[model samples]
Target: MAETSLEQIRSRVDADWNRIVELLKSKIALRSVSAEGITGDHMKRSAQFVADELRKVGVDAKVVQSANPDGTPGAWEVIGSRIVAPGAPTVLLYAHHDVQPVPDPTAWNTDPFVGTEIDGRLYGRGSADDGGGIAIHSGALAALGDELNVNVKVFIEGEEEMGSPSFIPFIEAHRDEFKSDVIIVADSGNWSADIPSLTTSLRGNTCVDVHVKVLDHPVHSGQYGGPILDANTIAAMLISSLYDANGDLAVPGIESQEPVGGLQRDLDESTVRADAGVIDSYTLAGTGSLAARMWTKPSLTVIGFDAHPVEGSFNVISPETTFRLSLRTAPGQRPEQAQEALAGFLESHAPFGAQVRVDRLENGMGWAMDPNAVATKDALEAMREAFGIEPINKGEGGSIPFIPELQRLFPDAQVLVTGPEDPKANAHSPNESISLSGLRHNVETEALLLAKLGR
Candidate 1:
C-alpha cells in the first residue's frame, strides 16, 4: 500500500471517473421511491441496473428475489462475487437502492429523478443519500480488477427508505447464502466535506399511535363551549406533558446516557429557524450536549396530530382525536422497554375522564459496533492511505432498524460503516448533491480496503 502506488491507481480511476458518474446518474434517473405508489417495475429496473453493472465489471452477480407477499411488491437483491485468492476474508457490503418520496419536483432546480452535474457535483434525489455510495461500491469493485484475496458480497435492499420492513425476514431466511466475516454499511455521511467519518452507533426507534376519546361526536362550541370536555384540549395537554419545560423527556423508566466519541456541530440558530420557517426564535427543546441529547438520550416527538382545525371554524368540541408519537431511544436500550415506558406515561398522565388507547406501530433495537475490530482497523488504514486523513468516529441519531438484526444473525462478524456522503450533501432535501472528490476518495479507500483485507 505505498502512497505512490495508491496515487497511480487513483489517477487511473480519475481518468475514467466521468463514466462512473454517468453510471450513477443513470441509476438515479430511476425513481425507486419505496414509500408510496412504488411499483414493482421500478424496483426491478433498479436491481437490474445494479446487477448489470456488477456483471460488466466481471463480478459473478445475480438478483436474488426475496419478495414479501404481505409487504411491498419489490424483492431484495444480493449481488456479489468472491475473490479467488486463498484465505481472503469475506466482506459483505450493504446499501439500499430505494429513494424517499419526492413530494415536490417543483421545489427542485432540476428534475428530482434526473441526475445533474454542475460545478463538479452530482445532484439528484438519491445521489448523496445512497446512490452515490452504491456507485462507489460498484466502481471500487471494478477497480479491484476482478481477482483479489477477499470475497465480497454486496446486498442492496429496495426498501430501506421505507423502514426496511422486509429486510430482516429476508436475511433470516437467507442467512447461509449471505454469510460473511464483516459487514460494511456505506449509507451514512461524513461529518463534513473534508472530514472522514465512521458511524459507531445508531439510535433505536419506537413509534406509537395514540387515540383519545372524550365524547361520541363534535358538539357545538357555542352551546357546549364551557361544559363540554374537549378531546382536542386533552390531547394537546397530553402531548405537552410528553416533555417538560427543560426539554427533558417526561417519560419515566427510560434511561439516558452521556454520548461519547464526537460532538455534534452547532448550527447557527438562525439557519435552523429559517430552515424550519419559524417566525419566532424559540429555544430548541432537549437538555445536555447536542450529541448526548440526540444520540444517547430518549426523545419523544409528536409526529402527527389529527384533530379539527380552526379553518373549519365549527366551534365544536371534538369527541375523538388521534395522534402519532415517535421516540428515539439510546443505543443499548431495548425498544420494548422504551415503548412500555412511553405507553405508561401517556396512560397515567392522560387528562381525567378521557379514554386513551395506545398502539405500537414499530419497534427496533439500537446498534453499537466494536470499533477495535480487525476489519475496522483495516478500513481505517485504507482510509488514511486513500485520503491522508484520520476517520472520525460518530453516532447517527437515526436508526438503521436492521443493524441489530444483522448483529444477532452474525454475532462474530465485524460491522463497518463507511460511505461517500459528506455533511454538505443535503441528503433527502432539495438540491441534494454528492462531491466528486468524496466519491473518488471512497472508491480509492474501498479498493485499498479490499487489497488490505486480501493480504
Candidate 2:
C-alpha cells in the first residue's frame, strides 16, 4: 500500500516533470567546467544562481564567500539553504555545480555546453554526471518547501570536478555552520538504468609521475642504436612491470578483496569493448567479475606517457621520458600509504644506471558506508517505492576525495549517496546524456524520503 504523503509527492513530480526538465536544461547550458577557463567571476555568478533558485523555493539561501590567505584571484563560495523544524534531524544536501572539460566539441551530436533533448535523453556534458542530481535535489525541495519537518542544509560547491581542493578548507573553517545529523551526497549513480542503487564504497586514488633520464641528448639511431640506452624503452619497461601477465596490479600492500555480490554478466563483451574503444588487436586482461576488478581490487593505469614522436622518427636515443601512474586502491586502504609503497617499488626496482624520479601527485583516502545504517535502510525503502525494485549495493570505482574528510568531521552523521545517473551516462566523456526517466524517479524518491525521514 502506498503512503498518503508519498503518493501525493509522486503525483506532484509527475505533474511538474516538464518544468523540472526545463530548469535542468537551463542549468546545463552554463558550461560550468571548473578546471580550466573557469574564472572567479563565473563562479560567483553560478553560486548566486543556485542561491537565487533556492530562495525562490522559500528556503533561506545565501552565497557565502571566503578568499585564500595567500592573495589569489579566486575565492571559495558555498551556496547554502536551511530548513528549520522543531526537534527534527538536520540533513545536509551536497552537490557540485562544476563540471569537467568538454573536449572534442565536434564529436558531440549537439553543442557540448548547450543542453539538447534527443529521443527521451538529455545530452550535455554535465547532464548526468552531476547536473541531473542537482536538478533533482532542487526540484524536490521546491516541491516540498517548509511542508517537510526536518531541517535541511544544502551546500553546493563549484570545484568538485577539480578534486574539491578548496571545499574542505572552507568547511573546516566553518565547521559549526555545516554540522548536521545526515549528509546526502547526490553525486554518484545507480547500478543500471532500471536498478536503483546506493554507492557503499569508493576506491582511493594515488597518482605518481615518473621521469627517467637515460641520456644527456638525442643521438642518431645508426650511431647510438646498439650502444645507447633508450629512455622510452626504460619507461615502458617500468610501466609494464607494474602489471603482471595476468593483468593484476603488482603493487603490494593494496588489498584486492572481491565484492560479495555478482555483476551484470548479461552485458556482451563486444558492447563493452566497443564502449571502451578497445583496439581489436588487444583484449581486456584480468580475471573474475568485472565489478570486482572495477571496485574491490587494486588497479594501475599508465594515464600519461610522453616521449619523442614517431612521425619525426630520427630513431635517436631519447634524452628523457615521463609517464604518469594512477593507482586505484580498494576501500580500507590509505592513499598516502599506497603512494609510499608505489614510490618505494619504483625507486628500488628501476633498471641499472637509469635515474628515475617519482613525484607524488594528488592522493585521497577511500570511503566505505555502513550498510546497516538507518539512513541506508530508509533510502532503500524510498528507492523501492519510486522504482518498484530493490536498490542494489555497489562500490564506485572513482574516488570522491572529500567523502573521507566529511566522515572525519562528522563521525556520527549518516551519509547516503544516490543519484539519477547510470553507467552509460558517459561522464567525463563526449556526448554525455541523462535518462529522463532517471531524473523523474530521483526527484520523486527524494521528496518521499523527506517525508519518510520525518516520520
Candidate 3:
C-alpha cells in the first residue's frame, strides 16, 4: 500500500510498545468512571490526558464538555485532528477514555486501577474496553508521524459507560468538526488473542425499570401473607415471565436477524461456558448455534432490583418493589422498538392483578457492517498483514450503541470496527486486561489501514 512495508510498521510498533503501554497505564490510574450521581473531576482528568496525548502527535487537541438536554453541563469529551494533505480523505479515529465502575475491588487479584503486567497481558480497569482503543490510535499516530497520508481526527468520549447520554448533542453541535469519510471505531475486541476479527454486527441495548405494587403499605406477614402474595413475590413472577422455558426472550414484536450472507460464526460451547464462568450444573439456554444465540439473537438480563436486605429480618410484606431489566436487541431492531416491546410485555404480564408500571431508563442503537465495502476490504487486508493470517468476520452480542448513531449522523462515512481487546479481556468486570501483542498488532493495523486508504 505504501513504501512503509508491514515489516517496517511492525518494527516501529515493537520499538514503541513499552511507551504506549505506559500511556495506557497512566490512563487506567485515572478513575474515569462515567455514571450518574458520581461526584469527581476524574472525567475531566481522563479527557485532558487524551487531549494532551493527541497534541504530542501534532493534533490541535482540546478537552470539550457538551451541554446537556436541559442546557446544563454534560460529560467531558476529547477532540483533536491533524490535516496531512488537503485532498486526502479524512479519517475519524474513535475511542472512549471513560471506563465502567469497579463495584467490588475484592473480586480482583490485583489493583483495578494499576496496569499490572502479568503473563504477557496488562491488567486494570479500562485496559481493554476503550483504554486499549485510545492506545491503538495514539500508537498508530506516533508510528506514522509525518508520513500519515490521511487527514486524521480523534474523538474520545467520556460517558460511554453511561450509555453516551450526551453523545448526540455533542456530535450534532459540532457536525462539521466531526465530519469524515471513514470512521475507525476501535472499541471492539478481536475474535481471540491469536485470531483477528472485523466486527460485522452488534446488538443494540435498552433498559426498563419495572415497579410492582400489591398493597398501600408494608403489612404484617402473619396477618397478610395468607390472604395475598407480597409485591416482591409478584415482581418475581413478572421477571420469570420475561423468558420462555427454553430461555429465549419471550417479549412480543421483537425479532432476530440471521448473520449477513446467512453463514453463521459459531462459538465453541466449551469456550463459551469457560468465558462466562458458567457453573457445571447450570444448563445452557435458548436454541441454535452458540454464536447466533449470542450475536444475532436477543437476550434479557435482570440488571438491577431492589427488595429488602436479607440480613435484616422483617416479618412484613413489602408494599411495592422495583426492578430494572436490561435487554440486548437483535441487530435489525432499534433500541426504541426493543424498549417498547419489553415495556408492553411487563405491563401486560403482571401477576395476580398486581399494579405494574414500566419506566424507561436508557438505550443505545446497534449496527451491522457491509462486508463488501471498500474500507472493510482495506481493513481486512491490513489486519491480515498485521496478524499474519486471514481475518474473520465476527458479531458481538454486546452493544456499542454509539456506532449506529454515528452511521445515522454520517450516512456517507464508511465505518470500521476494530480493536485490541481479546476474548478474555473481561471488560467492565474485575481483573480486566488487554493482550500486549494484540495491542501492538492493532496499532500496526490502524496505521496500515490509514496508509492504504490515503493511497
- lDDT for model 2: 0.78
Which residue pairs clash in candidate 3? none
Q: Report clash pairs, candidate 2.
A: none
Between candidates 1 and 3, which one is better according to TM-score? 3
TM-score of each: 0.92, 0.94, 0.95
If candidate 1 were superposed on the true structure by all CA atoms, what would the RMSD be?
A: 2.6
The CA-based lDDT of model 1 is what? 0.78
Cα deviation of 244, candidate 2, in Å: 1.4
lDDT agreement with native, every candidate: 0.78, 0.78, 0.87
Error of 3 at 12 (Å): 1.2
Candidates arranged by lDDT, highest first: 3, 2, 1
Q: Evaluate model 3: give its TM-score.
A: 0.95
Q: For residues 300-366, write the lDDT of model 2, one tens digit per residue.
A: 8889999766787765778888899899888778888899999888877787668899999989888
- For model 1, how does the per-residue alpha-carbon lDDT over 107-206 read when each residue is reduced to its tens digit? 8888878888788788898998788878877777777764445777778777788777667778877776578888888998775566677777888999
